[model samples]
Target: MPDFSPTELAVPGFVALVLIEMIWARRRNPRAYEPKDTLTSLAFGLGSTVSGLLFGGAFLALFLWAWQFRLFDVPWSWWAFALCFVLDDLAYYWVHRFGHRVRWFWASHVNHHSSQHYNLSTALRQTWTGFLTLGFAFKLPLVLIGFHPGMIAICAGFNLIYQFWIHTEAIGRMPRWFEAVMNTPSHHRVHHATNPRYLDRNYAGVFIVWDRMFGTFEAEVDNEKIRYGIVKQLGSFNLLWAVFHEWIGIVQDMWRAPWGSKLGYLLREPGWTHDGSRETSDMIRQRWQERQGEQTKSVSTENPIAGEAEPA
Candidate 1:
């Protein structure tokens, strides 16, 4: 193991600055992050930084050693970095998709969905154990293909930075071409939404085109407003609870459910409501509005089902 200088310190600094600005800007409108939200975000953000960097560093070492050992006839070029970006993102899509579909991965990822507001601070509310689970598999190809360890770290960091700005609600849809090709605020908000239509939809990181290409793309519908947070709602803001709470709930749900339903709840799509409940969030919300006899505001105009996970 080589001495680590905590070079990734800048990642957290960048995150903090963005969070501060989000606070400053939202102060007037008062949609700024709530105190509990801030505390939870900080806990996960710091926890993830420590875990991701340490795990990433260890993998970085292995990547370096593999290159030095001449495991493959490696090629270096600007195009290689470009390829790395694509491959890295492709790997991310699967990992992210799995996170929503698998009860265990959801344990790690649920903290992110714990946030109700989609802002830069929301991006920092990441999972502490995600890197330990699905994130590393995506990087393995780079090592095997002989991309240098330093380059891999650089590309990973660069991808992280590129994704930061996509967290904002300030930016609307970019030009049609840009939105079609890349992930933007609009697309990411759809990813964060829990509205039945927006559940488990967009999973792309830097490129929205992947979702478009792969049939996961959902356009933002103007009439429907965005509501963030996971289904079943996280009632607490404690970081530890936020991280493990879903896993605990899944266990409890499984224990209480019949054996078959228990497996179905964890393995099947998240929207498969327990106890054969027919009404989804969409139905409940619409009925509530109807009962009130208010003019119906469109659910989010964004594609409803934007980020729904694949069934088990």
Candidate 2:
């Protein structure tokens, strides 16, 4: 039983880097480090760390138990570690996607997006209720495929470590080739953005390729300033509200919803409502796209390109 947790090793690095980013933010954009927001985000990090401590063991045991039925006896070789890393990332892509698409999962995940600031600290804004979401199941197939639970665990920690640096505004963009294959800061900013075009986009954990292959990739447009945080911003920095607001919303919605529609509140996408009062990410993006199209047509009518014919 190898007891190596890379994340545990990286805690000091995480803190040191955040402090570095704060100094950089002060010189670059002071607003990037709102004391309250950063504090809230750090608190989220602490709570999530505690929750992971309390819950991560059970999931590891479940993975080991599932390993007894592995179809192939995969060895602990360098190549095996590499393959497990790739496969686990693919699994993370789906877990992240569902964390947005399903309200139940979103209730746990929304807190990660609660911060309006995009800094290294934001990466620490993890879900305290992730165990409740049962999203760890997404990685079960890897165990069943013969990857050791420890191998997957180490790989996932590295996957998490890879994600931490990408959660910053300090580094604008990675080199072109690197950006093409890997998930860079520019690519991930789109993931954390609330801009309609960016909503629910770029769910990659380590590689941006999953998003490109799945047709969920959206490039960050330079002209459009991203509004970080959820569609309905948590205007208050109340730690409890930030952490558990969505879960509370779920309960309230389920209680008021008619019996038949009750489950919809739990299973449907976040922001979904029986009567369509609140807008889902899909609805908001559609409306934004239509408006952009209409604006393009209006501009074309007003400024016809030299010899282009006008509409009757």
Candidate 3:
């Protein structure tokens, strides 16, 4: 592993590319640019940028300590780096899968899913508390195996940069061979899709192969426009809300319900319906339509005199 500087390694190029996508998306569809959604993106973008540096800094500190203690001889060969890459990718698969499966981890990850648009800006909507919660711990095995800390950081950064380009609707499926082995824009779009069929699937970070191999892959279907955002939409631009809204909902459910259902609500699938309660998606839409109909009736009632006042 060559010397790695966390400060230098942390760049805003990803965010810049995402901004470009935002501009392109606006030009393509004006209605897609919701003010609240953009504000949430802005907050998440800033938080992600800051958090990336923090994660890098933490890893750098750990690397220094490991080197000082002479934990193991740093492997600097091509074969060694290659091995590290493979192992890191495997670790990342589990890390990402766990992030979706566990409630606490999902709290940080939910911000990424808060967007209703699939563009580069949505890619910048990342979790900030990941390192604080030891999300990086999954990479520890590489260090234990004598892969240089620098190599781990470099490979991780490379994987992240690779993922940035796929977060778009601008590109579709690649050739069958590429689509089979790689994470194309189509796969990532499905990952972002909120359709019942797509939810919590395609959690692979760098490669779509893991999802396919692990039976988590779901192909995008034609004629079914993907509805983005979580099943329970987060209606806020505040960073805190973007991060913790689901967590708050989880806690609220736990507070109001018995322990068994509380645990079940989180651990079960995302759209899990209790014996008596409907899924949040159905409930929200129903309530919205009810309120809309009531408002229409009230407006008609108030305007009745206008029609009767003809020549007055």
- The top-ranked prediction according to lDDT is 2
Residue-level lDDT of model 2, residues 1-312, one tens digit each, is 787899999999999999999999889989888989889988999999999999989998999999999999999999999999999999999999999999999999999999988999999899899999999999999999999999999999999999999989999877888887899999999999999999999999889999999999988889999999899998998999888999999999999999989999999999899999999999999999999998988888888893377698
Clash pairs detected, candidate 3? none
TM-score winner between 1 and 3, please give it.
1
TM-score, prediction 1: 0.77
Per-candidate clashes come to 21, 0, 0
Q: All models: lDDT? A: 0.72, 0.93, 0.73
Candidate 3 residue runs with Cα over 4 Å from true position = 1-12, 19-23, 52-56, 59-74, 259-312
Residue 169 of model 3, lDDT score: 78
TM-score of each: 0.77, 0.97, 0.76
**Superposition error at 223 for model 3 (Å):** 2.0
Off by over 4 Å in 2: 306-312
Report the C-alpha displacement of residue 16, candidate 2, in angstroms: 1.2
**Candidates 2 and 3, the one with greater lDDT:** 2
Error of 1 at 287 (Å): 12
Better of 1 and 2 by lDDT: 2
